[model samples]
Target: MSSLKPIRKAVFPVAGLGTRFLPATKAIPKELLPIVDRPLIQYAVDEAREAGIEQMIFVTGRGKTAIVEHFDVAYELESTMAARGKEMSALGPTRATPGDIITVRQQVPMGLGHAIWCARAIVGDEPFAIFLPDELLIARNGGAGCMKQMVEAYGEVGGNIISVLEVPRDEVSNYGVIDPGERNGALTEVRGLVEKPPVEKAPSNRILSGRYILQPEVMRTLERQGKGAGGEIQLTDAMATMIGNQPFHALEFDGRRFDCGSKLGFVEATLTLALERADMGADVRAMAERLLNA
Candidate 1:
């Protein structure tokens, strides 16, 4: 196993146009869309911070200024809240100190690979993490957050690790399925990756989750990566090239993942997270039960 460097940097690719959400996203980036109280990106950033990430690099496009501002200190707002005797603890996790975050523009709408490659300079030659803000993962049962779990697994396996979740076999065709080699507990040695394969052809039900701990070399591969499925440069294509060359593993996350990019998924995440909150859980549960029965 290659000696892995401590993952100190995380890349958040927020450049997409978020066409799925339409008019609402026309003015606001989907990443800035609120799951309930916090925006989707906040969850990802909080997870990154929890996993010991020191630097955050956001690959943004037009209309993504909100994301940058969200991490910045709101001096006037803070002052107002302070004077009003309002507890500002809710805003604590959203703050990022100076020099902790760097934003780069992904001027063009390429793909996930291109958005990530745009941050290659800030990433340097270190192993970094990629967090998809649209994928909201909640670690339950006192388990670590998805990225935290991956970082722990990375410590042991010391290679490129991608978070995987076991989807139903019939749904495997909708994701980039992993070709499993060997399994050790929740870690599976990744032998190969098959992107959006037909259900009959999928290697396994385990599909790539949005969290990843990838080596810097993958960025180099993406530099010259050709457009794959959907005429977009695919990150999976770049990652697959390193399968045989490096130690690659898939970590099954101990959490529930919500695909918040879609309307249904976004609603589900909001309701689920709201239902989990201490302040609102009882009320939300009561309302949900009443609605379900009615």
Candidate 2:
């Protein structure tokens, strides 16, 4: 525990062209698309911040400058808001301390592994966390954020830890399923990982929930890792190689995850978060009830 290096840096792969959202994503980065109020990326960054990450590295592509600018101080906007007596708390999450946000471009659209490798120079020789902004995870009922929960568990076991969730057995083939080794409550040892395996051959219902705390060594595997499942270098492939060599574990933390990358997921996340807000929950719920009744 004491020998392990603390996780201070987090990598955010926001470089995707966001073809899923089509025309809307044509102008805006999918990460910038709002769940309710805050953009999708902010939720991931907030979760990382809660987990004690000090530096944020964004692997961006062309037209993703807004993602970077979102964290920059808006002098004119702030002054205008101040003059108009508008509350500034809403923009608080977008603010970044000096030197906290770093951006590197991933010129080619390869895969998750390639995007992670883009941050290799900055992440040199340190354990880091990866946040996929498309996954909107909420640690409700006073529980810690998903990444924070993983960090706490990382402190105890001290190796690569991935956030896991038990999807239904029928949905096992849709995600990277873990072959279980040992289980102790929320933590499960990962013996093997199969990415989107066929339903008949799927090992377990536990799937990767898009949050990871990985040691720097995996970056080496990714460097040489060739295309696997999707004609692109998969991060799961790189991770699977490190299973026996490293202390790999999966944590089924307490949280609800919404895949905001899909249309259904985006709508679900929007309504769910909107219904959770103190200022808007009542109206949103009444509206939802009315819609259902109609």
Candidate 3:
């Protein structure tokens, strides 16, 4: 088999107003909202890096300066650490070199398709990965790092790869369902993709999670794609058109995904991550027990 093209660039769609978060998000972008110490967006970037992505491109909107700043170097902080001679142990592996990440603007709030299209100039001509920060996944050995696993699979198969999971038939209305044409272990060939089909009308139980590895041609389709559901450009519609042209598949991940976009998912991610932390686990567990008793 011919070796698959390596995916080095990653696109993050970070333009939403985060109205769901209201007051808090009024000042802070939801992507910058903290899950433990790291922001939601950082987890996505870290996941992409783990999957061997070299360039990071963010499609951000208004009032998102903080998101850009977060990835930028903290010179004052690093200087203080250096002065204290704690740079080695303190800023060690966590410190990322400058220019490792870049940012671009999405002036319009058209849709996911538009957000991705905004990165076209930076993305150039390469197969790229897109990870939605709202879906926070936690794995054991993988540690919510589904994209890393998908990248490994892509190296072998060489096509568009989407991370998916089986949801209940009723829940299928909430996501894009994969039409599995063929299967290879966790990898399933995608014959078609339907976003939010009715419970009784779904082709399969497989739901498209927030992870995607798409070919460059996808942007062209998105450019021509008219408004879809919600009167906005939909990425699903663009992917549906590419099914017959090239290989498209879904990889069922070995991890738990938390929908941090919703309140419940955010709370769950917070509590779960806290429980996994060595320093906070014992105390959080005690607090949970107290709440249960009350």
TM-score of each: 0.97, 0.98, 0.94
Question: Across residues 51-132, which tens digit of lDDT does each residue of candidate 2 receive?
Answer: 9999999999999999999999999999999999999998888889999999999999999999999999999999999999
Instruction: Name the 10 consecutive residues with the lowest summed lDDT in model 3.
Output: 87-96
Candidates 1 and 3: which is better by TM-score? Answer: 1
Order by lDDT, highest first: 2, 1, 3
What is the Cα-based lDDT of residue 39 in candidate 1? 92
- Clashes per model (N, Cα, C within 3 A): 0, 0, 2
- Which tens-of-lDDT digit does each residue in 126-173 have in candidate 3? 899999999886667535479899888888888799999887677899
Q: Which of the two candidates, 2 or 3, achieves a greater lDDT against the reference?
A: 2
Identify the superior model by lDDT, candidate 1 or candidate 2: 2
Report the error of model 2 at residue 69, Å.
0.6
Error of 2 at 171 (Å): 2.1
Candidate 2 residue-pair clash tally? 0
Clashing pairs in 1: none
In model 1, what is the error at residue 60, expressed in angstroms? 0.2
Q: In model 2, where do residues sit more than 4 Å from their true spots?
A: none
Rank ordering of all candidates by TM-score, starting from the highest: 2, 1, 3
